[model samples]
Structure formats: C-alpha cells, structure tokens
Target: MMFFCCSFMGAVAQADCLNTENLLKLDAQYETALQVGSVQFLDKLLAPEFYWVHNLASLQETKAQLLMRIKKPEAQAHQRRSHDVSAHRLGNTVVLQGLSSVDKLNPDGKTLRTSRYQFMRTYVEQQGECKLLAVQTMKVWSSEGN
Candidate 1:
C-alpha cells in the first residue's frame, strides 16, 4: 500500500510539471503576439472575458478594447522578451510569473521607449484550449541596484 501511494504521488507530480510546461509554451506564444501586435493570434489566445492591467497607465482593458488598440494605425510595435518565467498549475488554471523587457517602436519604426516589467498572467483551459484570462504588470523602475 505504501509503495502504491508513493508511485501515485510521483505520477501526480510529473503530471503537474507537464501541465506547467505546456502552459509555458503557450505563454511564450503570447509574448510573441504582444511584440508584433498580432490581433489574430491574440484573438485565439485570449478568452472572451479577458482582462489586462497595463504597467504604465494602471489601466485595465477588456479583450475587445485590447484588440481595438492592436488594430490602430498609430499603434507601435512592441519588442518584448520574457525572462525567468515560472508557471504554476492549479487544476485547469495556470499562472505564469516572469520578468520582461520591452522596447516600443514608433509607427516609423524608430525606437520610442524601453522598460523592464514584472508580470503575472493567468490562463484557464476551456474546450480543450488554453486562453489568457487575466494579466497584470508592474514596471521595474530600477534594475541597477538589483
């Protein structure tokens, strides 16, 4: 009985890691979408009730609003890269926490702004697909001393 229980627990642990890994890959695709302002990619990845809290404005945007912004002609391209990403699986939900650096480019393709941020995103599985539910980001003011 003891051996059976140990094996079952080990299997559960391995399953959790596998789930986390899958979510991490999805999160990477999300980062790419953000950088390129891919509305189509975002539409597929975001839940209908998705919400995002921006780091600079402290503003919250719904899925529709976010898609609208992405379609704007003046919208800048964002080059974002995530680092030290960690995903935690909670049943059908996964939470991703990471640090990211972003470079914002103007419509003319000139670099306009750059910043580092810490972000947390939650993804929920629905209909055999994972979608982003909510995300919140905070700017990292100074990495110099760290």
Candidate 2:
C-alpha cells in the first residue's frame, strides 16, 4: 500500500510539467503586470513560496513583499523589455533566462533612470496552474542616460 501511494504521488508530480510555450506566455504576463503595477494580476501568477533576489543581493523578497512593492505607484516600471530570452524545461520546472531592461521616467517625460539586468526565473506547476516560483537577478549595466 505504501509503495503504491508513493508511486501515485510520483506520477502526479511528473504530470505537472509545463511546456515552453506556457512559460513564455506566463513570463509575458508577469512583465505586463509589473509595467502596469497590477498587484492583483500578479497575485494569481506567483506561487505562495515565490521569492526574488535582486541584483545578486543577499536580501530576498517573498511574494507578499513583492506584491506590496508593485502596489506602490512610485515603484512601477514605466517600461520593461526582455532581450535574448531563452527557456529550458527540467521535469516539472521551466527556467527562463535573459537580459531585462527597465526604464523610469519623471513626470515631465524625461528619463529618470534606466537599468538593465541579467535574470533567471523559475516556474512550476502548482495546483494545476503554472506559477512563478523564484527569481534571481544580477545587474548587467545601468545608466542615468538623462
């Protein structure tokens, strides 16, 4: 009985893998949510255990903290774009890697700050839906560019 139960759990886990296309779609949705500062939209995409490490920092922000920051209008991204993004699938998880660029603008329509970073995000199937699990990023470059 124990062996059968374990086997069943393993099969269920194996069945939860997401395809590359779904990963790309989810990544797009996440980027749009960040640009628009849509906390409610992001809330559905990120798993409960999701955490992000920014710019190779020791500090890690959990899902709630991330959403809280996104909810603040001042912290929103004016524009964000991804370049050279690649996706890899590993069993039940999909990893996305690429260079991400973000722009911040002042109320006067001048560029306040521009930043670029290399980032990796992991997504996994949870409760029959694809959910973002974790993110790690390092600053590739940044420019005031004003």
Candidate 3:
C-alpha cells in the first residue's frame, strides 16, 4: 500500500522571493505536522478551501477530508525526506516545489516501501501566516533496468 509523508529542507535566502524565510518556516512546520499527524497544525496551515491532489490515483481531497483521513487509526505512518526544494513568488502567492522520498511503514514502524515524488504547493498569506491553498504531486517512476 502507498501512503504520504511530509518532509522539508532548510530555508535558503532568496532575493527573488521576499517571503522565502517565512514560507520555508511554514513548510517545515507543515512537514512536522504531517510526520506526527497533528490535525491542529494542519488546520492552522491549510486554508478552509485548501485542496490536495495525490501523486497516485489523482485523488483530490479537501482540508477536512485530509484531516479526517490522517486521523484514522489505521492510517499508515511514514517518513519523508525532501531535497531540491525551491520557492518562487507569484504576485502574493508563493509556490514551493521539491522532490521527496516517502517510506511507507508497517505497523511496527518499519519501512515497507519507498517511492520518489515531485510536488508543488501553493501558499498565500492569511491572517499574517502562510496557509496552503493547493497542492499537486506526481510520483517519479523508477527508471531502473531500462
């Protein structure tokens, strides 16, 4: 079975994006929230109308659905490690793009599977904090034995 994992890299100052630092901080917080399945943190970080598109199945989920899904007892726990993360500013919105490796875990917390993915998350400033607006992800298919 496949699952989701959240990961983030440290902030890198960028002149092009004025809110790079703030965005990076939010990103890290989001990763932590996902890692630990903190519904409250996700509630604060995601806008009411936030939408997420999964890498596999093209499944679309709302903030509420995502919260409920993650809160399930049988939900898989996994770790994500991200790299090559970068942020771009588009008007008042910030788009974070990165590559992540997700390790699916068994009941005992042992890794069962690992997959690579590329994702883009859009964020906007809301109430003096960054909130996720939308997210799109695509799995990176292995090219081995080609």
Candidate 4:
C-alpha cells in the first residue's frame, strides 16, 4: 500500500531511453514499483534476461529472484526515489547512472533513516523500444533520521 500505481509501461514501449525525458519518467516508475511491490509491473519493465549486481544482497541476482523478493512485504521500501538520472547513448544501448534514496519509516510515517545507493543500469534499444538489460548497484551511505 505504500507504493503508487504501476500503469507507466505505455510510455516505456514507445519512448526509448536515449530520450532523457523518457528515461527519467521510467526511472520514477521503477522506484515507485519497488516501493509498492508491484511485481507484475516490474516483470514487464525488465528484459527477458535481465540481471542485477546488487551490493545490498552481496551477489548477482537474476530477474526471477528480484521479482520473487518483491512479493515479500518486507522487501518493499517505505519510501524510495531515484534522482540524478543521466543517459549516455552507446550505439543502440544506453547506460544510465543515478542515485537512489530510500527512507525507512516508523509506524507514525516519520523517517527513521535514509540510505543512498548509486546504480548503473543498461538499456538496449531495439525495434524502437528500450529494453532494460542489467543493473549494478552499491550503497553509497546511510544517515540517521533523514
């Protein structure tokens, strides 16, 4: 219930990541899905062979594992947002760099802590659509009561 709705894929199929506006929009949708545990939406956002090098988990995880974890209520973040979304086009692929902010809150909806993560994601454009290829993330830092 913490995450918002996940009807954002319409733009994903049409707007390639090479367009910064589209990239940022998808980025927002991605974070929103994570916060809400929208596994169905995530399944479509990821490519067939998508994988993630997640430092928080200390290992590489496949798309299936990622989706399974999202089904657990504990995996959903109280609040999550990604910023500094920059796209660099490389041939038909785009490498995106961004910082994600995750806030852990108490029952009163007050943030008890905040964590920042740096992530690099790859998107391969094909047939006028951008497919998410892979993502690597590392926790940059954490602060109390942010």
Question: How does model 3 fare in lDDT?
Answer: 0.68
lDDT of each: 0.71, 0.76, 0.68, 0.78
Per-residue C-alpha lDDT of model 2 across residues 1-146, encoded as one tens digit per residue: 32333333344334543666546655766776788777766776788999899976856799999998887888788888887899888777888999899887866766567889899999888766677899998887878642
Model 2, residue 5: distance off in Å is 37
lDDT value for model 1? 0.71
Better of 1 and 3 by lDDT: 1
Cα lDDT of model 3 by residue, 1-146, tens digit: 11121222112122222377757766766665666677876876688999999877568899999898888745534676667889988776888999866666655654366667798989876545566889888988532311
Model 3 collision count? 0
* Model 4 ranges with Cα > 4 A deviation: 1-7, 105-111, 144-146
Q: Give residue 132's lDDT in candidate 4 (0 to 100).
A: 77
Task: Assess every candidate by TM-score.
Answer: 0.75, 0.80, 0.76, 0.83
Task: Name the best candidate (by lDDT).
Answer: 4
Candidate number with greatest TM-score: 4
Candidate 2 is scored at a TM of 0.80
lDDT of 1 at 141: 53
- lDDT (tens digit, per residue) of candidate 4 on 1-146: 22333445665666655577777777677788878888877787788899999876688878898899989876788889888778888688888898998877655665457789899989787777666789999988888522
Give me the overall lDDT of model 2: 0.76
